[model samples]
Target: MLDAGADYLLAAKANQPGLMGEIERFFADAPANLTSTVTEVDKGHGRVEERRVTVSTQIDWLSGDRRFPGEYRFPSIATIVKVQAQVYEKSRQSSQVRFYISSRSMTALQFAEAIRGHWAIENSLHWVLDVTFNEDAARSRTGHGPANMAVVRHFAINMVRSHNDKRSIKLRRNKAGRNPQYMAEIIRA
Candidate 1:
């Protein structure tokens, strides 16, 4: 991404155990002077959630030649971020912590907003596909079948969303499924 003149924020998952361990250790012993933090609270869906974001720009070591043998070098990493979320539901409470590496130098609040925006897309689009189309339960797993079906589903979603009716997407989908003329109208729309 840095070579392409684009900045990125990527989650440090367990697949890269070396990188994850390095980041975890850095944060575990990080000094106050090297980090910035922001916290936000939200209440909805019968839950109260709190998110705490911490960021640090002291990442020169990650790209330097002093790294351990066989350790991957991250280039132009201007910031590292940690997000800890606490969710309080009706009968239980849970917490999770996630780490991310960013090529851009941004403040803690900016990282928080960016992370929230990313999840907003997941919730709005993926969640809708799972609920309204049962995409997760699909049986097309061979060859190009899954990709082809995904395109068809996206096209159908676009057509349904473009129709004039204010009905729910599930209702519109059912109407189109049963009514050829209504389907034609939706296609025309």
Candidate 2:
């Protein structure tokens, strides 16, 4: 995306073991002066949550040529972020830490907001898909079948959302299943 003049923040998950390890070690060993941090608290949905976001811009060594011969380098990485969240529910509490790499230089607050916003949209879409289409229970696990079905589900969701109806998505989907005219209208929409 940097080649296209766009910046991105992406999770550094286990799939990138080397990258993840490097980030973890950096946060664990780096001096306080090398990082910027921000904290936020939110209360809702019967839970109180606190998020601490830390960011570092000293990544020149990460992309240096001194690594193993074929190791990949993250190009244009301007910042690395660590987000640690603590949540307190009615009778239980939990904590988790996540890491991300960003192409843009941003304040810790901006990173926190960007991460939360991304998850909010992701959770909303997944919740709707699971509730309205029973996507979680789908059995399409063969090669390419799961991906193909996901595309179909997303198309159906968009079509239903476009149709002028006061009913919920589940109800609209049921109506479309039972009524050919309604299905046609949804398709047209």
Candidate 3:
């Protein structure tokens, strides 16, 4: 990433157990003013989820030498982020915690926004391609078949999405499948 002059915000998962442990310890002993925090709540369909994000740049004590298991150094580690998600459904409640490292110095809200925006795009595209187009169930893996089919699906999605109608994508797709005039209108638009 440094070679490309680009910044990265990477999730710290089980693969980096040592790093994750260090991050947990760092946050546990963090000074009250050393980090910034932001919280968001979403409720729908009998489910409520609250996410709290905390970000800090106080990493002088979090060098590669401080980690256990192995000596691993991440270049340009500028911020450490912790996300705690609490979920409530009916009378049951659960919670999870996740960690991340970023090359950019960002506030907790900024990191949360960036992470949410990234997932929004990723989820939108994958859901459209998978549920709307059934792209994953396709057996066109030979040569350029997969690539060609993906391009065609993307073109169709773009065409349908570019229409002026306020209808959902699935509805628009269904209408286009049954009505030639509507399909023409979408293509023209």
Candidate 4:
């Protein structure tokens, strides 16, 4: 959950019913034309659902400490969200949501881009780990092993990703493991 402390673009789900309810109520009462958006997507199990939502406007949803931006103090202010998703298993459906918030004023289109960029990191990092690294499959619930292994993996992944060479991280790590010279080059580079 450690992040660079940018504006939070949270996904509304049933898991947090109270929070979702609060957001809904806030949006219902916010000013018109504050935020706006359109979205389309096919995701999840095997269904596609397209939805467009134009927040008549932006409203004051920030309350206490859980406000939109964590009080870092940005200049402009706006939040936009577009959702697309799909659900399979017993049934099939997909949906996607685009959201944006800023301390500096921004147009709807700019908001769309910002929101998209914000969420794509999840697709690139967390999703990749779940699929390629089998992160969620780790079942070492015995003790510190799980936590320790997770730390090592995160460190290794960060090291390889931080490399400037054109070589793929997988190859870079393999080289580092097999050849001392290559390892030195990687570590020193």
- Give the least accurate 10-residue stretch of model 4, judged by summed lDDT: 69-78
TM-scores, each model vs. reference: 0.83, 0.93, 0.67, 0.57
Best lDDT among the predictions, by candidate number: 2
Model 2 is weakest, by summed lDDT over 10 consecutive residues, at: 65-74
As for candidate 3, its clashing pairs are none
All candidates in order of lDDT, best leading: 2, 1, 3, 4
List the pairs of residues colliding in candidate 2.
none
* Candidate 2 lDDT by residue in tens digits, 22-98: 99999999999999999999999999999999999998878776558547667788999999999999999999999
lDDT of 4 by residue, 1-189 (tens): 214545544455555555456556655665654645555443554544444544423435443345453233323334434343333444544444333233434554555555557657767877755654578888888879988988877776777677787876667777778998877766665
What are the per-model numbers of colliding residue pairs?
0, 0, 0, 30
Give me the candidate number with maximum TM-score: 2
Ten-residue stretch with the least lDDT total in model 3 = 63-72
Clashes of 1: 0
Question: Model 3 Cα displacement at 18 (Å)?
Answer: 1.5
lDDT of 3 by residue, 1-189 (tens): 789889999999888888899899989989879999999998998999999999999887775455554766888899999999999999999999999999899889899999889878989999988878887899997999999998999999999999999998989999999999999999999
lDDT for residue 34 in candidate 2, whole number 0-100: 95
Q: lDDT (0-100) at residue 131 of candidate 1? A: 77
Query: Which candidate model has the greater lDDT, 2 or 3?
Result: 2
Report the CA-based lDDT of candidate 4 relative to the real structure: 0.55
Worst 10 residues of 1 by lDDT: 65-74
lDDT of 4 at 136: 89
